[model samples]
Target: MRGSFLYIFGGIMDYRKTVIDKLKEVDSIKDIDIESILEIPKDSSMGDFSFPCFRLASVFRKSPDAIANEIAAVIKTDLNIKKIEVVKGYLNFFINKSKMMEETFEKIFSLKERYGFSYIGEKKNVIVEFSSPNIAKPFHIGHLCSTVIGNSLANIYEALGYHVIKVNHLGDWGTQFGKLMVAYENWGDDEKLKEEPIKELLRIYVKFHDEAEENPSLEEQARYRFKLLEDGCEKETQLWEYFRTMSLKEFEKIYRRLNISFDSYAGEQFYSDKMPEVISLLEEKGLLVDSQNAKVVNLDDYDMPPCLIVKSDGASIYATRDIAAAIYRVRNYHFDKNLYIVGTPQALHFKQFFKVLELMGYPWSSDCRHIGFGLVKFKDKKLATRKGDVINLEEVLDESVARTLDIMKQSASEVDDYTKTSEIVGIGAIIFTFLKKTRERDLIFSWEDTLNFEGETGPYVQYSYSRAKSILRKANFNENTPYDCDYLKEEVEIDLLSKLSKFGEMILEAAKRDEPSVIARYAVNISQTFNSFYNANRVIVEDKNVMNARLNLVYAFSIVIKNALALLGIEVVEIM
Candidate 1:
């Protein structure tokens, strides 16, 4: 079911491939990887694709235009290449749009849900660790980036035939847990904790810090509690386990709302028992050093602060646990790539630990990646959990759904299931807003931009998809019936078909870049192009062949849009 698209779209995968094959014939550039240099023109008027002649000028000893013309002279028009134009020393090829439409529509109609699936990652393994919120803390807006980005990457990898293990490495072990325990014992309301675990826990946790500011000895008390936890004291361990259990329950509710699931819930505490083995290995490797009554791996030669393995209190630090976890994952999963979708602020920590792994003679340390993202801020204010200045993700999602429902009511749209549709749109709106921009860019949440039905937002994408579905319904599109692509001759129709065909290509690119924004931006582009096609031509035309072609195109668009959104971990509504 999954591999059928390859056989169907085989040679006619895309115009880019055709251009690469055609450009391979030019002797002067035969040594170069033509695919790397081939580029899509920013403006459609420039041509469908362009290759700069600037690089070839040095070899040919000619001006870029002269080289472009020389290359154009030999590469005659083929079945895939309709025409080649030289503009400002660039070789721009206009694709055979009719052939593209025929091949694209056939694959889209035949493969259905499996249209974008590829076999590039066959037999490969990858571990995507994300959405790892601290235990007993609110899952705030700041954590959203890692959650969606990691989930989307896992989805993208699976689409490309990689066995992905999604991990939520919960921050279940830390001094914070000790502080939370102290706060719970001192000021926690058991009734409130049962009613709202995260909220009540966060309240007392914040209060502990506030009081600790006045009572300096509270810090020592928190450390003592943490030492008890480390020493495996029965009471401390039980309380820790209780906190962890409650946190996981709360987290599961949020995960269900987002439609996300994880293969592993292993947190820092999972490595507590495993750390001794790692420290032993480090000691054997002669990597561990003494630094200010702590175990350290000096990285001064690499221009980094020494990675502290064990603190002065003999407690293992995050670096030590991370090293243990990486070793465990490699031995267990044998992952080709182990990606950590964390914040950019922790760049040094990852680099230091990964370097320590390398120094310890682990070659796979190079395969470990730190997929860092920028901060998430509400307007100008940054979200800080410690400061109690954070918005719960559930609150944002609820408001989004409410606003979407209000919008639907105001617009008086046909909503068969108002609750379901509103949730999809509202939740999807927040997810899309995070994904629409580059992950490295700090996100500033905006209500106006997020739920705008007409803007390039989640609702806009969902509505576009629903609109396409509506068109297919009106035209009575049938999957079993044959359709002709010959009648899809209008520019907008061809453009829409062109975008539809790139779905697989887009997925492959997203996988390669480790960026879900590629898929997000592509979805918006497809929606915008689809809208243009719908406005220009009516699908249910008087001409039978034309209507069939247009309807088939609409069906194809709907599938591609839905698949694109799915890759971003956003749900689509058939009617919005």
Candidate 2:
């Protein structure tokens, strides 16, 4: 039954190809590959869809214009395709406006929120690891990209019908914990911690680092403390548990505000007991070797650096824990794909880690993927928490909400729900800002640029939706009212309808590329196109037929905007 449903739903798989399939039935060409035939013309006036025949000219041994004319001739005979023209090696297609609008709008309204979602991934499970912040450290803006981007990718995958497991991968077991423990024992005040948790912890951490520079012995002490912690010292274990529990409470608040929840909160500590088994398997597979008082996996055969799984003191490193984590996930969930939403600096580390896994003869290692993104810097300066130069993520969220509230108060009149609208706009702005560019490119943080309401910003798109909502409210559409698609023959209306048809395609592309920015950009494009239509076409005009059709178009626009925003982890409000 599931297979039959998949086959039926798969007919609408590639929308771009659907347009080609329609063009192929023209009976002029014996064969047609839409991708090779069609080209989106630079100018809007060319047509909604265009096919350039320049490439075909070489095969046919004829002038480009002549081949274009041949295709256009066949297109002209089809009633569904209203107009076809050939100009400079290009065949332009214009659909019958009324039919196109009616059919497209009906399909969109019928699907509703599920319009763009598909079973492309089927039942495949994807494991995503992200937001692996160290315990006892403040969650700063530097960590925002990984958290939001990872969560958004997970959301995108799930929407596309993949079983997504979000793993926090917290930095729970590390030398930093040892240093914190030492600081706590020497000068830490219990009353101060009860009063101010993160602040007091941060002060002690900073003090440890500052003092360590002058006292080299402090470094050895820190390492020995970590060794003791790893050796299962009762006191160290209790302290580590206390720190993790306290820190998670603070982290949960931020995660709730952002609407991000993980299926698994397992961090480095989760794989502690599993590391020995991993080492035993590695040694059995003849992958592990002794290297300078450590258990290392040599990767020179694959032209990669060796990976250290255990230090001289028999403490497991990140590579060891990661290998255990990977093996555990594969066995536990049987995931088809595993995604690590880590930063670019650790790109080499993951490369080495995966290479070692492959050498260990884990065939499923090929299915593992590391989705590395560039750093999020402040004014081109790296945000170093040790140097106390980091911005808090909570502060960024608070400021964005405050700014959005101020804008709503000044511009909007009688906001139906101020709190809801503020949350929507504020969260939407942050998500859009983070996803505005490709993940591979480094972005400099700037509030002025991110919060811009006038241009290609989140608020701009949200405002477009709000504007459509306002029009719908004023139009008071009724179920019995019949819409006249003929009223939507205007240029802006045609353009918007064409843009709306590509929503499903856009979502698929974003999912395939693992980039949410594709959807973000499409939202801006749709909103911009709709705004142009709204400015030129009057919805509540004197003509009842025209008003009803225009209202239907706006209603459809609202649905698309809301759906797109949801995919980006943004909230949509009816009024702001």
Span of 10 residues, lowest total lDDT, candidate 2:
6-15
User: Which residue pairs does candidate 2 place in steric collision?
Assistant: none
Alpha-carbon RMSD, each predicted model:
2.9, 3.2
User: Can you write out model 1's per-residue Cα lDDT over 1-576, one digit (the tens) per residue?
Assistant: 324544535524556667888899888778887777889888877888899988878877899999899889999898888999999899999888788778888778778888878877789899999999998988876678899999999999999889999999989998887898889899999898888898899899989999999997887888889989988999999999988888889888888999999999998999999999999998999888998899999899999999999999888789999999999999999999999999999999999999999999999999999998998766623323344466767767788899899998887567899999999999999889989888889887778779875788999999999998888777677885567878888988888887787788788778788989999999999999989889988888899888888888888888988888999899899888
Cα lDDT tens digits for candidate 2, 430-465: 878888789888977666666776888888998899
Error of 1 at 22 (Å): 3.6
With candidate 1 superimposed using the best TM-score fit, by how many Å does residue 437's alpha carbon deviate from the native? 0.6
* True-vs-predicted CA distance for residue 83, candidate 1, Å: 2.1
Q: Assess the local accuracy of residue 129 in candidate 2 as a C-alpha lDDT between 0 and 100.
A: 90
Q: What alpha-carbon RMSD in Å does predicted model 2 have with respect to the real structure? A: 3.2
lDDT of each: 0.87, 0.81
